[model samples]
Target: MWCLLPTPLCLISVFLLLQAPVAEVFLYVVYKQNSTCMDFRALSACFGPPVPREGLRGYLTEAAPANACQPIGSPPASSNSSEVFIALIRRSGCPFGVKVLHAQQAGYKAAIVHNVNAEQLVSMVADDKEIRQQIAIQSVFMGKSASKHLKRASRYEKGQFWSHLLKYSAYIVIPYVIQEFGFMINVVVCTITLVVCARWYKKGQKITVCTFKRGDKYDTCVICMAEYEDGDQLKILPCSHAWNTHTQILV
Candidate 1:
């Protein structure tokens, strides 16, 4: 038997069933030597909110229980107020969503769950509806190799500071330099245009009363040899030669 759902019920089903695609998240790790920074794109979980395009930054710390299948403790206290912590948990013991929920409960900004073995990265799917609904912060799955590299590099602070310092400085400086360069180019273009107009105005032909001295070359038309009369109009060439307005010089 064929049956049609009511409009309201259909709309509700669509809203509850559909899942929007999330953008990929790239994790940055600052190395121990000279703050050299390298980045790896992790697979986002089926659950949790999408990370903002600009992304989040924090120091990496291993989960208290290592697996994070149960409730974990809060992040370690730091004197620096701006310091935020992210939890690193190995993949095992429970579903991905449970691990993420534990990390979220412990006041971490985000969670990175890595593979237990050296396997290719896979998307972390929510095991149950209850856990998925409880998780809020962004959670991503990392490969074993990348996670090992991060664990080694997380011990250094000098490299992280300088790498992030340069990154922030570029965000502010690059736009300002581009704007100043554009303004200078516009000024140069306008100056050149004004100079060309001024030169054209000075060299252009003009109409004036015949008030020049009798012996002056401008007193007569150079092309027609016609003597100038009072109120006679004169056409001036760029070469400073004058002629009657009606006269036509072939060359």
Candidate 2:
């Protein structure tokens, strides 16, 4: 069990190794208006039909009710579902599958749900198996940053600040660090533990004491001038000296 002691760095590494990563495919959506276009990154749903590798090209549309939790009436003026359209919905009020189903009923080809806050990416899951089976179109979760860019692109203006690469660097880098340097980290931790045990062992060395024999060559304690008896205890030193002192040197 001595070898089981983990250093601070090892604890951190193990914690990272045990983390559950949200599984999703990363893809970018290109929003175009007139002659200008800008690309925004999004995370694909873990459930539902996958977005095609060639990508889904559609007109971006905001749902009539915004949440898309209920039956939607029609596509807004900015969108035309006749030529494939993708619905933009907010993150609350109902299950993600319900929102996507409402968008599907309104003739949208796909749906993109944006979080209320600029936060970590989350995997989208349907509320039940029936909802999962009914979803035929692809849906994705959009971060607030990307949603903000989409709003800007709607007005045909490019965003000035895009720092999603920095915002999400920790999630990408931690897993990579654990995968690449995990063995070396274990070796370093074991080495430190061994070195600590060595120092403790050296400091905790025990001096052995035994019963004195009456007829030994030296039969007296040099410090206290006490005679040795067969049953008397003697303290043995490293220099081959034995003493039978009743107080200090005797055990």
Candidate 3:
């Protein structure tokens, strides 16, 4: 009988364990609306929508698209026409200082960085506020695929792609799993403990009340002037008296 009892309990535990992860995943998917836009290319194109320009000054000199124009409010032309200007570089490879210096040297008006995966966008600033160049900087996460495309397009030759994999794994994936497991264990343990305690308390309980006798040197309840008896339910009043169901005095 004990073995059979454990089988059912184990089955229920397993069922609950399986259901916990599914429920957690469901809640996560429901809550995280941005994860759905993790495709880096899609996110980049959305954020970096082409701004139409009328003049050729803002267009890329190498392969300027016919429709592409300089963005509005660009700084005045630089003296060195031979310098190259680029925008929207990946943030992972390029440090903020280097990007600012590059922008100043190239006379670029702005620089935007997309995240490694391009899932979200952010702005970048130089740590040293003294170098106040007339350049703006921004960042975005390009999701894995979009980041790869940008990397390839930018001709990134050095640095292994997997260098940051361990960091991501440790920070994101492992911590999430550990938190979920801890929550599940706590729920199951608490539920089982509560059930066991409730059953133990209900095993041998009796409901009885105290009986009182008149003039038995007993303290009387101020409200009802009644005395308590053994095994009889007594209500203790604030005026140093115990009251029984029947309003009789026993001292």
lDDT minimum window of 10 residues, candidate 2: 7-16
Candidate 3 TM-score to native:
0.28
Deviation in Å, model 3, residue 165 alpha carbon: 34
C-alpha RMSD between model 2 and the true structure:
14.5
lDDT for 57 (candidate 3): 14
Residue-level lDDT of model 3, residues 172-213, one tens digit each, is 356658887999999999999999988766642332334555
Please write out the lDDT profile of model 2 over residues 129-223, one tens digit for every residue: 88888888888887888777565543332322211111224664576568659978889999999999998777445435788775677677777
Point out the higher-scoring one by TM-score: 1 or 3: 1
TM-score of each: 0.52, 0.52, 0.28
Each prediction's total of clashing residue pairs, residues at least 3 apart in sequence or on different chains, is: 1, 0, 23
Which 10-residue span in candidate 3 carries the lowest summed lDDT?
Answer: 8-17
Winner by lDDT: 1
Whole-model Cα lDDT per candidate?
A: 0.64, 0.63, 0.34
Model 3 stretches with alpha carbons more than 4 Å out: 1-86, 92-94, 114-125, 132-134, 137-144, 150-251
lDDT for model 2, please: 0.63
Worst 10 residues of 1 by lDDT: 8-17
Off by over 4 Å in 2: 1-22, 33-37, 76-82, 155-251
Candidate structures ordered by TM-score, highest first: 2, 1, 3
RMSD (Å) per prediction: 17.9, 14.5, 20.9
